[model samples]
Target chain A: MTSAILVSILMTLVAASTPILLAALGELVVEKAGVLNLGVEGVMLTGAVAGFAVAYSTGSTGAGLVAALVAGVATAMVFAVLTLSLTANQVATGLALTIFGIGASSLIGAGFVGRTITRLGPAFPEALSGHPLLRAVLGHDIVVYLSLALVLAVSFFLNRTRPGLILRAVGENDASAHAIGYRVIAIRYAAITFGGALAGLAGAYFSLALTPMWADSLTAGRGWIALALVVFAAWRPARLLLGAYLFGAVMTAELQFKAAGVTVLPPEALAMAPYLATIAVLTMMSLGPKSGRANAPACLGKPFSAS
Target chain B: MTSIITRRRFNFGAGASAAALPFTAGRALAQAPLGVGFIYVGPVGDHGWTWTHDQGRLAVEKEFGAKVKTSFIEKVAEGPDAARAIRQLAQANNQIIFTTSFGFMNPTIQVAKQFPKLFFEHATGYQRADNVATYNARFYEGRAVIGTIAGHMSKSGQAGYIASFPIPEVVMGINAFHLAAKKVNPNFRTKVIWASTWYDPAKEADAAKALIDQGCDIITQHTDSAAALQAAEQRGVFAFGQASDMKAFAPKAHLSAIIDDWSGYYVKRVREAMDGTWKTGDVWGGIKDGMVKIAPYNDAVTPAARAAADAVQKGIVDGTLHPFTGELKDQKGVVRLKAGEKASDELMSKMDWYVDGVQA
Candidate 1:
């Protein structure tokens, strides 16, 4: 391929990967704090609609992003309350949140259908953003950079900081942390809220940056794929970034081959490639050393009452 | 005066006898405001397939005024859920129910059997019973017009088609676009990509960008979203919208669109049922019947190209042009239709093979 074509492909790949990476990173933190919230998909949908509606009505992309973050956090709290307080089944409650998100987003977004918004544009100046050679690196919107920065920050926070250590301690052994006076429940709530915020931002990425238009169920189950990425990453923020990009590349390969007039495989097979790759990667991750399986928190998915 | 009196008496006698018949009892009950119900497979706000259908429902309400009462449930999933939804409409006393999705075919038939007194209409489906009727638009006719425009406007002679499925309806559109493009430039080629979905904006946008990167100057989609058109606009390529006019989404890149106009048919069918003339049959209406229309050309289209497109549309409407005429060959170089022979409705409905110059 030509250099220009390669750059175009890279650009599309980055765009495709950013949302999942953002969502997966948040889930990684939540799981690290010993909570499993499967409501990522639903929260994302709510964020998508909230972002689109706010952006369309106010004609401001920043306001729209804020709205999406709020919507995401709010939706996440529903799961947090039910699972963290009421002691509901994490799996069942997460699934219910997704269904509710689909219905509620559709209802909320009903008026915004067919509406268009000015897409979130590049953050840098046109001199660098428009240069053919430098454009690939500089042309991306703010969210793409934010996602990468978050990966690094999360990696540092989980492995280096004192609070990060405490959060990990709570996840590893909630009872011991509770006895140590770490406020296990409060930390878990905070972690869940953070996850919800990131998921909301990821969801808004679809509406405000990726497609720049509104439609019902626009996320199209990408949220579920983000959930899978958390496991594929073994709950590591850095690995989550790599997994998200890998998935993005696999997703773009089908379109690339068809566009290049390479008909080696049928269209159906090409469409199935990314999904098959997801399953394969997950299986390979599980097949590694038994210690890899131990990466999951001991207290993960277990509710702590501290009574 | 005596002759007029006799005629009036004869008309009254015929009407009384028709109402007295057991089979016509349901028609007699139509004197009350006719209730029309629509079942959509997607949200009405989709701005594509379902949106057009909902527009038709609105037309029925506008045309009949208080004589007709219309209701619809959007995003109704096909299969078992469809049957229940249809049954609920029937129970609510909707005299005519329009199930607007191919997947709803069997369910529509099943529900019709349970509610024999109701009139049923299914879109893009083949099944029919005494109470069931099937209707479709000749969308290929509109495709041919746009294809001719794409051929004339494209600089690279390569067009990209983002298809939803390999169903006969979508396959036929691909073949029709290629055949028309080839007529303009025999060396013209079309690249086809299957998204495997009817409406995913992100996937559709990616497909458009990929095609544009590989030298496709014009893009068209059978999927229901404006993403492809928006991509074309951003990439400075030409595109045609699907199902509805998406000119607003991509004002500069949108050359023209094949708009599905179901208002005429919906209004007519409702009128037929209201007048007790409804029947079980098939209706395939095209440009002539006002079922398929071409949107206005963009400012980018040359006057010559615009005239050519208009000519093609006129030819199809006047029965002088046939998209699947003789001299057609499949991708394997086997003749599908010999010269001077026109394709029958049955053959067109199940067309699965691509014509020459189509790359899938």
Candidate 2:
């Protein structure tokens, strides 16, 4: 029974973590090339509304997913031009991008209120869907599988590939990279855009797969969770999966506790568990020996300069 | 064929399409008209408060025809974003603006002061100016009935209330529910849970479950979301819906719902504004006025329950029933109203204390 619960919990975690994982992986890549796009939330929201609207109109979930990616990329391009091209403050520009994305998406989603989209049917591998322990541990819609695969793929690219190494070197020391004849600005822009695409994909997953409907402000700070997960994973790709899943499990447990008849805690307290856990994790990580320089990229928030 | 020929001939003579055209079309076509703007804090769905207001807007367009043009921005954030959004709408030539949301009260008042000629209507606020009119539904009237029903139906002598804020509007509902529940079951007590949000499904669901786990069998909410109904269904508890009919989310669990109908008020007010008859006043309408409605009772309600609810409904409509009749007690059992005394508007408006049966 315990194993069954454990397996089911794990499966649920994977499903819940996909959007965050997909988003974090993209940010992982972006960070490796030294662009900090704090506008992931806005980009994801844009993707969510756009994807839902298109899918709603076209009656095709695939089309909706594509539209989400495109929306994310388009919004990201705006951020790229402002920060990467115009040499604006990365943090400020990223914040501005998030604000713009929120306003635009909210405007678009207003008319979509209370409208139902056709649910995307199950996407788990057939064999695992029916299996008892295996099903609970492995089964989920496509987003979960995509998130896992992307994590592994990102880890491989960052550790083994020539271009991935160059990206990392640029993030670590852009001046040194510039001196060595690599185009830092171009690399960071590409990385930021790719990050935006992934964030968009994450947003699409929310509307197209998870809840499968459009809602105003529906992302509910999930983007911030993705960003925090990046830090919690110590900027490593493999740990991102574990950290996101763990947070998902904690969130799921809060709901399940009330469902399974735990009456000890008040509902407000239960609702606060996940946020409180995030705070605790942040505090623990900050207090750990690896403090400042161990996990974060040295030039994580620094903008690339030609000089 | 003969009928079709006659219908065609009738159409030619009657000019149905031409008649359907707005008489104001000529005037509108002569010059570009001023744009009107609406800003909402919620999405305009088919049910609930926002949906009702949107329906009202559609009514205005239908009534005024082409002479008046109105547009809306939905799900606008409260503080700075609201200011910017209002400015944007004003810049876009919106001469009149309606800002909906409690948080928009001060901002709307401030913005209206900035644009004196521009008319502004705000919902659920007291602040007003020559151009700013305030409006709200008398939600407490509906709560009084729900309270009575809960008082009669509660099996566990415990009820749960999902509240959105600590404001007087929400607090009044909580107190009213508790008072009514106490009338039916003197031992009955209520657990008040604040989710601190108007609409968060996950949080609302958990709150419902928590209340149920604490032994509350009847649930009422002053928040948005069908999650409470969903939670009640899972727990096989009796619940009441808020804002919108959430029967789809909790068909078996929901006893009834409080639905807001803004179309009537909206159409009247907007037309009045367009006709230059719109004066700054506080409009608060309830059951008797048809602004608030209780949906059909579910199958789970017993014959006695149905009869009781029907009787209450009749009383409300015929002025024979009073939800806030005299002889009410505060949480400390202090008598706030004497027997046969009607609850004053002043008392209801400033009600900040919970009744005796509610557990804070």
Candidate 3:
């Protein structure tokens, strides 16, 4: 294959992986804050529909993206109030939030379906962005760059900063953190809401950039893939980036090979490739000492009460 | 998560259109309108397969006027949940229900037995029972025409087929498309990328991009989305739409679309059920029956390509053409059909191998 083919394949991998990376990065922060929200898929849909609707109505892809983030944050707030403020069962409420997102987005998106808008443009000028080799690094839309920057920001926030330490401490032992004068529920609410906003952005990438149209459940279960990716990454931001890209490469390669009239494995097997990898990573995580499970938030999925 | 189902119930009489069927008005006014139920696997807004079926449902409403009330449940999953949904409609006084997805075949059959008095029509499935009937459109008939265009128009002598799965329905399309392209340019090649999904715009677009990058300039899809067409549009290539007229989605790239017209058959079947003539059987309607049709040719199509495509379309309708006529060989050069012999419905339904020059 020519270098052009290789470059194009790499480009496809980036497009396919961007949304998952954004969602997983936001989720990493939420998990690091000691909360487990399975509503990533639901939140993404809510964001996707909002983004498409706004973009279509205002005729501005930029407005659509802002609407997606705002909608995502708003929707995530519901989960926050329920689980953090009211002390509802985190798992059940998260699941319910997902259902709410799905139904609500469908209802709201009914009129916007089949509508198209200008796709989010490349982040750089055409001359440099479209260059044969430069395209690999600069060909992406704003969301792609934002996603990468967010990864670094998230990784730094978790490992190198004072508040990051406090947040990590809260996740490690909420009771201890509370004794140290940190507000456990407040920190969790903030984390969950941030996760919601990112998930929304991820969903908008589908409508605004990927396919450039609105459809119900347009994410098509990618949010679940994002959730699994967080686990696959062992709750680490850097690993999340690697896993998302690796998974995207496998998926894009499946189509690229078939389009090139070749196949290394059965299509069905390729479809299940990521889940198989996730399973292998999971088994190794459990078997290896402190490499996998050791990294999970201590207070993950557990509800906290100040009293 | 809470599942989202776009439920559209045509309760209000279709206003003045109801006046067309006045002959049955007195009897209809004396009783509740016949309850017609439909469940789709995708949103009506899909503007693809489910959208066309929704059009059929609307035709039923328009034809029967106040004599029949139609309602549909969209985004229905084809699983154990399907059986529950089917039963929900059955028990809700739906006299005749249409389960419009292949995966709902078993559940439709199962529910038909439990409600033996009600009629059920399952699309794209062979299963049948006393109260159940099967029906589908010959999409490959339309494929042959598009394949002709692909052959004459492609600069690379290659076409891309983004398929949903390796099911016989899909395999037959790949072959029919290739056969016509081969007839035009014997050296024409087809690349098959199984998307393994019925509807996913993002993945569909990705697959189309991959195919275009690999030199297949002419794109066609068995998957139900205009994303492939849009992708081709962005890349300045040619593509055909599936299940509906999608020229709106990709005005530049769209060569044409294979429209699924279920309105006539749906109206006929509903009329038969009301008249006590509905029977348990299989119905495969094609161009002859108006179940499948090609959209208008784009002006970009060379006059010769248009003429060849029209001839095949007309021939299929006149019974002078068969997309899978004899001398056909699999990818391995093994003859699947002898010259001058048309393929059997059974063979087409069970086709599992690719035709010569088709890379699967």
Fnat per candidate: 0.61, 0.05, 0.68
Question: What do the candidate models score in CA lDDT, each in turn?
Answer: 0.87, 0.74, 0.88
The value of fnat for model 3 is: 0.68
Cα lDDT tens digits for candidate 3, A1-307: 7878788788778999999999988898999999999899989999999999999999999999999999999999998998888888988998887788878888899898777788888888888866678888877788888998999998998899998999898889999999979999888888988899999999999999888888777888888889889999998888999999999998899999888778789888998888899889899888887765767888998889997
Preferred candidate (lDDT higher): 1 or 2: 1
TM-score of each: 0.94, 0.74, 0.94
Candidate 1: residue pairs that collide: none
Considering only chain B, report the TM-score of model 2. Answer: 0.85
Q: What ordering of candidates by lDDT runs from best to worst?
A: 3, 1, 2
In terms of lDDT, which candidate is strongest? 3
In DockQ, how does model 1 score against the reference complex? 0.38
- Listed models, DockQ each: 0.38, 0.11, 0.58
TM-score between candidate 3 and the true structure: 0.94
Docking class of 1: acceptable
Candidate 1 local lDDT, residue B184: 83
How do the residues A20-62 of candidate 2 rate in per-residue lDDT, one tens digit apiece?
8888888888887878888888899999999999998999998
Compared with the real two-chain complex, what DockQ does model 3 have?
0.58
